[model samples]
Target chain A: DKKKQLQQLDNFIEGVLQEALEEFKQVE
Target chain B: MEERIFGTECEYALFHQLPPPSAQGSGKTAKWSGTSFSENLQEMSHLLVCALRGQNRPLAGEFLANGGRFYIDRGSHPEYATPECRSVADVIAHEKAGDRLVQKLVEEAGGLMAEKDIPGRLHAFKNNHDPRGNTYGSHENYLVSPRAMEKIQQIIPFLITRQIFAGAGKIPHLAPPAFSGEDWLPFAVSQRADFVEHVLSDRASDARGIINTRKREITRSGDNVRLHVILGDSNMSEYALKLKIGTTALVLRMIEDGLGDIPAFLQPVQALKVISRRPAGVHAVEGAGSGHTALEVQSIYLEKALGYFSSHAATGEEKAVLCLWETTLSGLKNLRISPSGVIEDDPGELSRKLDWVIKAWLLNRAREKKNLDWSDPHIKHLDFRYHDLDPETGLFERCASLGLVDRVIEEEAILLAMEAPPHNTRARLRGGIIGEAWGKDVEVLVENWESIRIIAKSKVDGMHPFARQRRSVNGLKANLNDPFEGCNEALLKRVRRFLDKCDEV
Candidate 1:
């Protein structure tokens, strides 16, 4: 259960990073 | 500085132990070399930078989404610096945001290391001292007028004695060269007590001091001095962090107004060490015209602060701090005078809001259960784990989840702070410019606290640290300088115009 929580946080970070990268690509 | 701005720089280690290269599963009997250590640190730093850059975000400068930033420091430790904030609440929010940011980065790095089949796990702790006698720091910065230097002298005694409540309690360690024999403490109120060797010094690492005299100004103007404090422990309790900064700010305010006569400590550094070791107020110091215990010294300052609050109109936060300070002093006094040596009135109540109390409670419980001595390694491990930043495993987070500790900010507030800056300070503008240029083909250079350069097209100069207006090099101005003012239409329009022009050919 604790590992799952950590995975969720990691997933959240990955998602934010992906979104930011996508936005940068569009702007460029 | 009109309102005291606050910021913190937190340095944290990456790995608990650096395994030798030969110990790796590669089956090569290579001799241990410095390259292994360097390589490990470099890998860690690279992973951290990648995490900070996010998936697709352009690396503009040192700042992140919220008022947080991180970089690799001299010792290969990752250091996170929160953006300047106007209130203690905002500071706490941004500081917690720093913790989240660091945790996220560390987790990502560990995953990467595992993928590469690294030999050891990378564990991070938000604490000051390592077992090898080296010290990291959680330095607190406050923007004060240059004229407040004299007032700083009056506040040193209060700073020395504030450890009774402000300390992040530590398990006993071998005494430093300066302190031994009877002075060797079984427990210390502050983790940084043994390392502080001077009353005031400019050096941070070697020859550390209570009040740092570093004369570097981050602002554009020469009117304000940044009061950099390196004495405090890296606190895990939000309530303790709030009170630590809040009470200090209140005392500084009193000093600036020339409202109280703060007694001088005969030997300030020694007094700091003594009070830190024996925070229950029994240790006597020769100062304030007579020998006074830490409790008496604190009480004197508390009385003067109460007098100032009664006469002056204090803000809601100020009022809260006054009440907490009074209640804390009373609790300490009661604990000292009682023959039982136990807090009888409301057992474990203070533990909810104070780090030292909460830690003492946990340590005492463990000691009774396991029949362990104060210097046991398990006790030290428990102390270290309390300050770990892992959400699922950190002792402080576990206690907070069970409602054993009081929280100063809500979880949602901290989450929001991870992506946005506080509304009422120059950080808002800083965060605004960085957010605006997040994905655009523009260079956002934050040279210092007072100036931001936007791709040589628009250079905004915020000469006054508290002012909201950013004067463009091309004479186009955006006035959002009021620290309390929220986003206004006129300022937004002006900023948009400047940004639009930068976007143009």
Candidate 2:
């Protein structure tokens, strides 16, 4: 369970940054 | 007074001039020569006055058919309906009207016109001397709850992107029937302005296509549940100009409402204009045509407002900018009613269905902890709940994923219970907030305990307002008896529909 929680934490942060990056890409 | 009442009852206003008849040439014995533009306008105006006086047609017609057309100039907006003048008889009546105003101006100018005293001189007023342009336009929107923006932002970009699909393609050039290579020439650009030009110019273009493809046409599916606006007296203060700019303000609010899924470009566009919640530095795009019906003019002003607030997002005043945007589209002309009873048009029924969707979604979302609900399989693990939640293979990630799996399973069941397009309800056109669609919905929900009593209380109690104390605050004037009392009636109905729908499942 600890392993899964830690993994999810990493994935979530990764996903947020990815989405933010995706947002930034089309701005110009 | 009778004439005024009769004119007001007419269905639509004409914004364009009708083409002159084809058969009339310069030298032919003047047919309908007595029917000059000035005479027609005078006749029309007189007809109204006479009708109001309870005069019958023959007498009213005699007053209207005043001798002939008069050519006089007034610096009125082009869209203001003014008839053309062609005869000497028309000139006399026209000069008399002009005399009323011109006599007050610098006497010399008025005297010179009197001396020149010819229909030709009066007609000169119609000449387009100053080319610099400005637009006369209208803005429209429907009222939705404070919470609608968050949901709408998730879907508007998808609507914007599909413009090409719903819009007709443009072809610039034309070939003969037997020429063979192509039937039409396509335009270089696909945005609305360019499309409007091509459609208007093309002989092959179909009018129905333009109407059907308009973005203003409601989307059959989306988070947009309402559209409303306040028709400002444009002659009023700069506040009216700001009201004109409210469309962009609304877009900014939608961004802040955090419905997400909106296109990225719109986010920064709104952010760049927001300053401390008060929008500043918003600027309209330059060189947009000032045509009354031009979307370009509307969009330009809207963009300017967004730009101003977007560049100043760091200030505390930015908060008020959202308020400015929230009331955008408060005034409009066409009164839409979701009909009642067993009648059968789904479009008419959209208001209640949309109300139900928004209310249901909000309730469902409010009950959850995540920013985006993981109820659907398509949305599984799509949201991050807390700062500590990580995504690189941990228990939290698995928990999130497992939550999504359970939600997706649950969502399938919920979707089954969800209503389909048109939702099997009928909408009818009725007077104001009293119609069947709104009336029944309100009747069903007004007694419910969980309803937003503030909305009802604001309408009935007037003294206590919902949002707060400010320039927009409701004083004793806010009572249900006030004209704005009618505005809340619709809101009350929508709230009721939402509550009832929520309780059904």
Residue pairs in collision within model 1: A17-B55, A21-B56, B467-B481, B468-B480, B468-B481, B469-B481
Candidate 2, residues B50-81, lDDT tens digits: the string is 33234221111111111111122122321111
Model 1: runs farther than 4 Å from truth?
A1-28, B16-39, B55-59, B176-185, B220-222, B281-290, B336-348, B456-495, B498-505
Q: Which ten contiguous residues of candidate 2 chain B have the minimum total lDDT?
A: B1-10
lDDT of 1 by residue, B187-211 (tens): 7778887789998999998898889
Q: What is the C-alpha lDDT of each candidate?
A: 0.69, 0.24
**DockQ score for model 2, please?**
0.01
lDDT of 2: 0.24
TM (chain A) per model: 0.64, 0.57
The most accurate candidate by DockQ is 1
TM-score of 1: 0.81
Question: Stretches of candidate 2 above 4 Å error?
Answer: A1-28, B1-22, B25-140, B150-156, B165-185, B188-263, B266-505
Error of 1 at B390 (Å): 0.5
Residue B40, model 1: lDDT of 62
